[model samples]
Target: MILIESEFPIDWVISPLPEEEGILGNIFFISRDYMQFIEGLVKKYKPDFVVEDKGMRSNEEILSDEDEFTAIFKRGGISYRMVDIPEYALNYISSPILNKKALIKKFSGEIEEYKRRGQVHYNDPHFQQLVMWYEYLKEDLKAQEEELRYKIRESWMMMGILELAKKQQKKELTAFFICDKRNFDGIVFLANELDITSEIINIKKVAKELEEKNSVEEVIKSSVLEIMPIKMKKKEKIDKILYFFDTDEYCSPFDTNMGYDAGFDVVIPYCKMTAERVAKLIQDAMFSRKVGAPTVFFVGGSDVEESERIAQEVLKSMVPPFEYPIIIDPRGAHTTASAIVAKTLEIAKKHGIKDLSNKKVVCLGGTGPVGEIAAIIASKLNANVFITSRREEYVKDLAKSLTIKAGKKAKKIEGVAANSDEDYYEIIKDADIIWSVGKAGIQMVSKEIMNKLPKNKIVVDINLVPPYGVEGIEPNFHDEEFYPGIYGIGALDIGRLKYKVESTLFNKASMTKGKTILDYNVAFEIATEVLFGEIIKISI
Candidate 1:
């Protein structure tokens, strides 16, 4: 059934289901959620095109295989639009685009092609070694090629579809893979060692062979000592050059060893490749365990347009299933945001400033995540938090949300929305602590404002720009108890926290056997534990 609403309709449409021959072209059927989302987009945006997700199936085909779908529409007539399915359409579509029998046939055809003698070739001895290695790996991996492929696909689909959804919404997205550092380091070390060992062996053999044959001495003796003064023969062309010491070319046995040593079983091939594989392993474990809710965070942009590029890059790096909290904090925004606020509170309490009961904390660019988080944290600490933004509307809405999120304590959250230098200076005058969390090059608070503040006031600028947001604080400045009465911190202070937090989270995640959600609470708890020195240092 076609759902219609009128306000602003979607401009374009894309169909993920592949088109087939026969009677399935005319019909469009999709899940209720997809349909609703489309309906909402149509009503709100009045977009020129809408991608229909479901296509038709022939009655005859349906009778034979109830799961089959025919073909997709070349174009959506009238108000509708049709576009090619994103490459991952197979996973998102409700019904199979190709029949099971046809799929099998196609796969068999591929296998047949690979079976051709010329198609897959290696030295016989090498091939045997590879086969033995494959068998050994298979025992450990515990799955056949097909099963592994399926797992990768499932994981990729889970990751890719969410990314696709974000693309539809035009939101910023990021994808990353995490792995055991030890494993990767191990591989690199092993590969390098093998290469070195082989080189040394080959070099020693050649040098020993060369050193034993003293052509120079033999020639001198034959020419000078013989009664007939027999002239020594010229040296052989091969012996004229010292090839044993040549390190320049792949002809060296060492370089050849490197190729064998650096394969997948070695250092995971590449950092990104290893990350992708580890991500797949984690995803599969989660899928099998089925214990936790999964979340993917697309942090930076409000719309999907710019974020799609980053998302696609991440997806390509992953094998199939790219699953995890893919948070895109452009410029370390969210990570920095969460880290600074959390760290400041801990440091403050440790410094004997117990209660912020009546103090005012000013956050520049407070509408941004970092500034906003600072405000939230201050409010939680019972300190009055003042937020600033360039746009009044933005600051107002952000403050309201924080207020709502903080409930009764949100009343303590105040804000000023200004777009110019004068406005920025005026906002920080009463600030007990001034936080700078804005664009890279922009200065939120001037030196004049910093001077105007009470000598005892805390001026902590997280900005690392040359002309920092708070003007005077240098990027390299860390506690060192700088400025007598005034406290200061730079980007590095927060960076340390970020690294520790990430390391701890990675370790915690590694220990989890199944799919696990890395949620706000999880991050929060982990951060707190790090602050309290509860978590043990991870070796890798």
Candidate 2:
């Protein structure tokens, strides 16, 4: 958890005498004069323990209410400790203070004495000033104690709400209480005032507007701005990275909320993101964590170009030799596409699906994006390949350009007309294997065509629509032998291969130094490794 303490109020600082344990959570106090505000904040931000800075005061200026500075963790069974803030962490987010040396000397001496002897007598002169501060706040002290109790109860409720979020499947609910920064001066006073409590409240109205399911930017624009501090750019910090592999489809903000609900110290979303805007949005999500580590990113979106750019930008932002963990391709398209075809070739010999020596493999919709790549992989595997497109001219042009790029003989490349199922069948009938790579809804193979396949024919479909590319085929179809005793592969089986390859590549990607672009070959190699059982099972 990345802890953010915008400012710490000096006046509210009090050296609590340990009844059991010192406060142990992080504190982000912002004002000194408003005791009421501090009182409320202490409850609202009721940390595990606090590293409090008790202020210097004359004997007459000290608060005398022992109850005002009550320690109720014992009664509630909550252990907390308050210690002096470390200078390194303090420099980044702490408030300015006066007479630092004197304060350090005073507190350090007390800490040393407390550590040296288990018991420090209250009657000792060293404890006199500490006793005076407690006495000064004693008049209003009882009310403060009540406020602390209320906060502990509220913290328990907050934890419960988080638990409920985890139990609920597929929905994300994030809560934030926004208030005016001007009112910050009266934070301590506000804590004392009951009326101000409700003003800074839950995110009901904002959540309602977002529930309408508009875009993320719209919700962010409509809800709150106080949380984002302009001019607070000390530097764009990249804390750490989290990876999600082969499960990008189900990876959404709601999924991220689930992680937060589960009490992850810091949950950074980093899978299935495919857009550039998502990269920037992840940068913003870094602000939410507030206890351990620095601000990190949550990178997930559904646009490929954007995801690529984000990968680039994130690498650039990281320190030299970047070496940050980034997880992409969990959705399984870019990585899986290359992997499936490559793996097929690796196992082709064992399956008796051989003879790439001048044999042609027709890729239906070959000019289409995925088909084009499938053709390239087949060509690289030493198969003479013919690519077809609805528009014959486009197929011709693609083959011509690819011939040069691949450094293969241009004569091995061939193009033909294929605008519909009939044209598709005519072009693929003589080929050894038929690879279907088209839009989800388009059906290319019929039952009659299946019965007509050669005895040793091999067919692979990468479509995941309602009706499988070949009728009677299930998405997760698995059998020792496929349709009519001819070898066949379904979409989900390929999807599993895709997932395994994706997870492995993402794990390896975490080690990349900077500006690494995962290309077709990277996917091809990973898929080959997965087919050979060189990689572990893919994660969801």
Candidate 3:
């Protein structure tokens, strides 16, 4: 039966017996003092839809409103707009439109009385006084037509109501007076999160066009969602990652170790797969988790750009606050980038620098994952960071992406082309620190450029492969000063910390019970926390 959670006390529309499928509903109206406990009612009846009779709303508004619905259904596993029962949608003719034309006709008596009073009330008890009383009375009749004239237009709420009714097998939908918008909105919001099956319908327009209701029960004798499917009650009480990689290597043993070291009990690496392939696998794994079990996803590959796109697809598969968390650290970009930033801070601290404010830091080779992530982290640290590339277009694109990803730091970051020795000299004129996280074997900041930098500046190189990431920094150099007074960290220096940072994040995720989006920023946070002895969690 339909459950009308009316705002005002309702007197109309009696509920037909359970046997009568049509016009069957229990009314909770009249002094809607009980409206506050509507959630209790929703829990009690689990109604098809809480039919709110009187309210005005738009589709966009319904989509934007989610807080109330979430608050109402505190727990998960709620299916709203549960099924596509288009049969009711097609069959039902609106009672409002059918009775509208005849309504004005019924008021003919009062209308005539109103006219008669206009003519003869010239001297009742008092002519003007009688006229004023009748005029006020005329307003009631006017309001009647005004209310029914528009007919019933289906807002997003109404369409969802019928579908939900059908899904719950509460096919009896007879509606009322004030649809507080909250009930309608809340139901829709909860349903969306729970993945309710619904189809859009214009019931109001149908009521306007169709003059008569279909008395037939159902011509198709079919069903939509008669019963909700059985769900897994047990949340997989463990954290897992179907760590997908694009390369044939499946995954790096080092990366897999990082996950286990962080907090995951198991890390299953599947290599050489496309986004489409991995998306399906990911969905399967995420769905298998028990109710309270937490899962974290990790996406890593040499192709940082493509990995980010894959991460987007992974996100599309998740139901927020319900699904497991996902982290995109493609090609160790986020990890290494975070480590680079932390190392920079350490160097700054050593030099007695208070903060990076107004400090100029030049990031060489800003097009790679490490470069972009480094730039983002630096910007967050309040550094005046300059990200350079061989081409202006790549710099511009990275600049735009960084601006959005890094927020205010994006403003402090400017993209420049540092292809030539002259470009390097001009860009690094005011540089206090330098980070060279260019592509493997690419000579980004040559000795010519390094020689031009200030004597006391800090420089870091993150390219571990042959040809190194920077000009003067050795691969094994930790925090060593080879360039006069310039302190620097080499590839191994950042690599060791990158491993630690990633491990710390994983461990943090393991300990966390709720969803935690572990990214470069989170990595940097854990890194800094580890440095200050604030982080106590240690994964074996």
Candidate 4:
């Protein structure tokens, strides 16, 4: 008998069925060291069967203790089977010996090729040790015959293990296989061909001083490092991809620019997208990439309702474990509204107003998307919100819709027709804060109306065009005393916050692990954090 060294290095390989197949456990390929710690592995992996190779013997001592090994399995109630290729079958497949010189040269060339390709595992000490062993074993005819037998036996074992794995998978049970360390790479290659996701565990590297009597629990207790499976090679970093969908005839360049600024490596813009067309596009984008790839979907358009419909379609098309982040900001309305509300809260607190609760807020020309979101946010803060438009019926319907969107128990919002000076005065006279979000270049609140407002009231104008939304309030003003006792916040000030809020949301969506939705509400929370240095919840 040719006895091998007992202190040789060993490796373990674990393969698992895909989660979609409903197999909850892993198939482990363990080394000789595992025999001493079989019970430890059983408790950790909870495998149902243990398979041992009867042909591969490392040393005489282990073979002499075969009875003790079988007794350990029996005492532990572990179902085990010894497997091997029959002597006749092994002889039938044996080939005539080749030239040793040519064989050694071929192996050397393969090792050089692997190194040239920058294979990371080539540097592993255990792998280098295997190469040294192979070089030494090639010198003798007996060693050469053993090597050939080991190769043939490994092929047979792979098939046998795969067959056993399939049987266990049917019963939803896990199996453990013990094989020689020399067969680890071959088994891994076969597992890959079979489409099994395998994890490699180099026993010698993970537990360097593993003793013959050491239990798995003791080894685990001594090591502070987590015993994670080793990846064969480092995975290349996937590109951060962002899909920007617009309902208009042409996609907006603003959103795509911000997407790149937020650190996305690729931003794909889709124009003229509808809810019907978004489903297929979402499915295609999601399935083309590997799982856990950083991806985001941004929705923007002039039409708020159409953009919302497309966003819902995106949500519906995504499957679990593949879902990415989605940001809904129709024409920047969500972020702008959040900034406006957060700024209002900051100014109100500075002016001795505790919160927006029960305070009257008048939104001039508040029927558009930005104005609508602002009104909803104020309503959510328990404010008595009044939205003014030229058309009373349209504004009233919008108010009712926004109230429902806020929540079932939210405060009611009132709509008024501000077609004349009397109507404007009626709504603004009792307001604690006045927001002008009317058409650009149009002044919703004139100097004459501004002079008649109550003292110590806050006013905000979000129009950068000439003849700003609120007359006498410049675009750069921020909480400035525009009138004797009236404070004003300008469009540029709110625009800065809006830019910060939108960019922060994009950054967060790119870095988040699982599916995240960045809507008006999430924007509001982030805005509060950006402005107040922490999130401040304002409830009634």
How does each model score on lDDT?
Answer: 0.45, 0.49, 0.60, 0.75
RMSD after CA superposition, every candidate:
32.4, 21.3, 21.4, 20.3
Among all candidates shown, the one with the greatest TM-score: 4
Q: lDDT tens string, model 3, 247-313?
A: 4355767778777766566787777645677668766776676654656667787777677777777
Task: Give the per-residue Cα lDDT of candidate 4 at 74.
Answer: 69
Model 4 residue 169 lDDT? 51
Look at candidate 2 and tell me the lDDT of residue 418. Answer: 73
Q: Would you estimate the TM-scores of all the predictions?
A: 0.40, 0.44, 0.52, 0.58
Evaluated at residue 253, the lDDT of candidate 1 is 39
By TM-score, how accurate is candidate 2?
0.44
How far residue 470's Cα lies from its native spot in candidate 1, in Å, is 1.0
| Least well predicted 10-residue stretch by lDDT in candidate 1 | 197-206
Better of 2 and 4 by lDDT: 4
Candidate 4 colliding pairs: none
Worst 10 residues of 3 by lDDT: 198-207
Stretches of candidate 3 above 4 Å error? Answer: 1-249, 272-279, 320-322, 408-410, 534-540
Q: Report the lDDT tens digits of candidate 4 across residue range 201-309.
A: 3443354445653687876666443233332442455789999999989888888899999999899999888999988898899999999899999999878889989
Candidate order, lDDT descending: 4, 3, 2, 1
Q: What TM-score number comes out for model 1?
A: 0.40
Model 2, residue 145: what's the lDDT?
A: 38
Model 1 C-alpha lDDT per residue in residues 169-285, reported as the tens digit of each score: 543322111111212233223324333110000001011223344588755444332111112232222111000111122233322232233221211111112222333433443
